[model samples]
Target: MSGNQGSFSLFQEILADQTQEINDLRQYITNQEQQLNTMKERLMRIRIAVLMNESVLRPFFRVPPRQRDPSYYPVIDMDLEAIEWMQANNIGGQQNAIRRFEAIYGMNLRKCKILVRTAPEEIVEAMNQRAELHYSPCYRRSLRDNSKIKRMKLICSEIIKLWEDCQSAAYPSDQIMVKRSNLERLLNEFWDGQGKKTEWFGKRKVNLSGNKVV
Candidate 1:
């Protein structure tokens, strides 16, 4: 009887030790996961900062005329130039113009289509005038810079708000993740809409003509 009791006591000690070790391992894994998430958040912030800086600085770094390559033409807010090119070449109809713009600029077909469809009539008229007067590349560069800076600032502010909301919400991890995914999708849609609006105003010759869109 005495030997049996001793054996049972020894087994309980072993089981207790195993349970504590398992808990310790779980704690270690949780700590590692938290650290990994922190690192990822930091990396995302850094990437956004780099992109914003690039957008701001890009207009200043004009390629020398001799070194300029057709493939390196700036991609953002070139709708006015594209339309002028289309008109000059006798490209008829908005759809045809959009397709030609996509092919010439190597831009996404959907984005090209959106910009063409959404451009205000006033802006198109201004582009026509600019084309007639032979606007300088400097004018185009200024337009692109302003559009890019405005979009970047808007996106950055929205993303900051999203982060703040996520951090302040008292939600479980899974719920927070779902919210983040949804926010990202909404952000992309907002970006697309903003691009179209920016193209509308950015391509407008109003700054030079001193006219405002009604």
Candidate 2:
């Protein structure tokens, strides 16, 4: 009976030590997981910063023609000449300017409004620069086709339809606020559909939709 009791005590001691070791291993695993997550988050932030810097510096770098989508046309012609003329003539009020632009360019009300509201001179200068680049020998040889431009026009028409729908649903008292909210919701939904969430990284409470909360 004495021997059996001593063996039982020894077994208990061994079991206790095994349990402690198991607990220690679990804690170590948890710590490792946490450290890995921290490292991943830091890497993600670094990657985002790199991408942003690249986008900002992209225009300054001459991308090889082979890397560029030859069929891709980025500039949308908004009748820059008409906009420049309006700006030069001191187009007074927003409404007046939109109306005058519409008349001058035979553009629809929506296009007229968009052009009048935006920085027309900057748009003109950017378009001119892009045109020069497009006419360059390397670009001209690669992007001689107009099929992509035609497709883009169709896409633009669809976008215009969506814009008009947003406009029609917006409240007159707070048109911009309502429209912006609706657009942000749509964008969030799009991201969600793609199995992603829209994330904003900033010190301020600014969202991906450019909305700031105090």
Candidate 3:
């Protein structure tokens, strides 16, 4: 082939290879999505089974308080030791451990909660006590127990179901909208149907204003 022909041939070969690579990537993503869906379904089924078991045990298990929503906040004194154990095991970093503690607390794990930044100077010696160190983590604790977690799960699961149904009904073609709605649903679940609950998902005017992600 002439030099000009050779160059054109090379460019065409490059394009063909790139197209094949793109096709392969697309197929990989499709397989991954299928796997993810399957896992979620399995997890949901397991959750349902657990809930059924809990229902069977309801008579023996202590009935939760009316005011107690099964959601309890984390208490530093109780949860911190576990957090430090998780951190030391490298399950997560310090910040991740802290954030998880915060999230668990938010999930309604405790009635009263407080997060300690560091041991106060007056309590520094007390904090270093071997017994205290054994019981408490560098930073983590739940003020509540698993007894109330059941109600919290029910509340969250209900909100998630409602959010899913809303998305399927209103925006089947666009799921970015669904995510926004889910955030709002979570807020409403937390706020118990307040007007401001609608604004629970921080305003994404860019998307809600009609700009679709796709």
Candidate 4:
């Protein structure tokens, strides 16, 4: 009976040790997640500040393209001079234009349009820099491993759409608070699921009839 009690005590000690270890691991994971969230929030604040001050930063950093190089493509025809130059130098039609631009910039037409329209000069400089970055074999090899870029772009686009929708929604002033809250909830839920619950290129059905539930 003493031996049986001794065995039981040993088992309890071992179980206690394992439980303590598990608790320690959980604490470590929680700390890491907290650190990541803090970093993300800091980065987001910096991003917003930079965006707010982009116009001021542009003069020093962005030299607008005075001439359209043959390698370049204009996402929009807003600038008549740029459009005329692009047309004069364009060897092929619309598809070729988009293909050549994507080949150099590593982004699609829609993304190009978004950036260019928002900050034409800066985007032009960025595309030129990105093109140069890809010139080296080492850089090219590294870029091939960058799977997150497209996923980030898709998520950003969706978030932007939600924000824009919230802005444009015809909600009354009293209901604006509720509308914004709903938009935030939708943004968080969908953004969290992106690349985890759903693949970047996964097909989703859309209700074009404007009858779908929100």
| Index of the highest-TM-score prediction | 4
lDDT of each: 0.43, 0.41, 0.38, 0.42
Q: Which 10 consecutive positions of candidate 2 have the poorest summed lDDT?
A: 197-206
TM-score for all models, in order of appearance: 0.28, 0.27, 0.28, 0.31
* lDDT-superior candidate, 3 or 4: 4
Candidate 2's residue-wise lDDT over 107-168, tens digit each?
55566457446523332233322332333332233243344333323333333344445554
List, residue by residue over 36-59, the lDDT tens digit for candidate 3. Answer: 978655543332222223232233
What are the runs in model 4 whose C-alpha is more than 4 Å off? 55-214
What C-alpha lDDT, on a 0 to 100 scale, does residue 107 get in candidate 2?
50
Q: Which of candidates 2 and 3 reaches a greater lDDT?
A: 2
> Cα RMSD for candidate 3?
20.8
Among residues 3 or more apart in sequence or in different chains, the pairs in candidate 1 whose N, CA or C atoms overlap within 3 Å are none
What is the alpha-carbon lDDT for the whole of candidate 1?
0.43
Give per-residue CA lDDT, model 4, range 71-97, as digits (tens).
222123222223233456562343544
